[model samples]
Target: MTETPNLKIPHGGYVVVGDGRRALVLRNEGHALHLALRVQHVFEAPPNPPTREQGTDRPPRVRQGEHRSAIEQTDWHTIAEERFADEVAAALDRIADAIPALIVVAPPRTLASLRQALSERLKRVVIAEIDKDLTKLSIEEIGRRLTDG
Candidate 1:
């Protein structure tokens, strides 16, 4: 496992813990040695069923003369995740300037979605990006992970 660099989140910096469904925005009031992370905002998306559960019908088949082709079914679950990431980015953009620095923690796919959704200006302020699903972690645990090796 690659050790994450010890993060000294500055005052007013944000640590966004998220996955495909929800995001917890935490702000650091204290410095590197004594980190105090307070949840500033919480964003949650509507629950989505699995792709198979969502799609009731089978994939449609097209026939051209003697040739037949089957098209891939749409992945509803993935689409929902991408949309949620966009919503999260928009929420952050509203207070983009207020955030002096940002630390994003999400699953790999969600992280990629957030990367695309974030505004260019907001992207510049990002200090670290951890490809892990950290939304389930408690506030104190998240703080320890950010600071401790």
Candidate 2:
């Protein structure tokens, strides 16, 4: 990893940290990093669907008498993560010009979703990607992680 100059913000760059449920956008000011944005969007899926009282309802068989089960469906949690990633991508796109460099910190799953959601334009400015869930870390800890090689 190329050592950053005291981990200062590259002009108007940003560092983003998130998981499936929450995200924190930060920017470096002088020698400190501060919260530049905060998204508290949460996806609360019901414990059970109206049709089923346990887990998600499985799709009905294609044929009434067919022995094969319906194709497995995507989980609500996965869908929510994708949607959150899209939201993050859109937010980054909106501030593309202001942020020339970006450091993304998220879990492996969320990182994958974010990678898929990012547009080509936004991809160009991504400087580093840390595959770890840092959403719960304090600001000082986050700064240390960003600067630590």
Candidate 3:
């Protein structure tokens, strides 16, 4: 009879945990995980302008009594988050070949953004994805959570 391979065993690979604000890159070392890098999004926080800026100039009114309106102001927070995701994706792309596998952990929205930002090649290496913000967790706690879950 053929034996089935054990699926519960964790493979050596990279573990990435983050939100839009910060990220942690960890690699499996023997049976333990070690931090390889930390990435922080300096622009994740919204800028503090001296005062609220005025909206874009209104569209010129037509002579026929109707007028077009400008689009709503940009959502800077969402933009920053997406930019952060792109940064993470680029970082992953650079190291994808070095890692045997990959596990991603992030908040739901950030995870979606990161998934969208990753290249198709990088996407193939992802072994698991946990939708939780673990960027703030300690290395030990993160390791435990990864193993327990």
Count of steric clashes across candidates, in order: 0, 0, 0
What is the C-alpha local distance difference test score of each model? 0.87, 0.68, 0.67
Model 1 residue 94 CA deviation (Å) reads 0.4
Clashing pairs in 1: none
TM, every model: 0.92, 0.73, 0.70
Question: Model 3 over residues 56-144: C-alpha lDDT tens digits?
Answer: 34434435457555555656667778988898788878877876777778898988898899888888877777788877778767776
Which pairs, if any, clash in model 3? none
CA deviation > 4 Å runs, candidate 2: 1-11, 31-56, 63-67
Error of 2 at 78 (Å): 0.2
- Lowest summed lDDT over 10 consecutive residues: which window, candidate 2? 36-45
Cα deviation of 10, candidate 1, in Å: 0.8
Which tens-of-lDDT digit does each residue in 1-149 have in candidate 2? 23354454454567878886777877654333433333323333233333333345665556556565686655666776788889888887887777777777788899889888988887887887878787788876777666664
**TM-score: the better of candidates 1 and 3:** 1
Candidate 1 segments whose C-alpha is farther than 4 A from its true place: 1-3
Model 1 TM-score relative to the real fold = 0.92
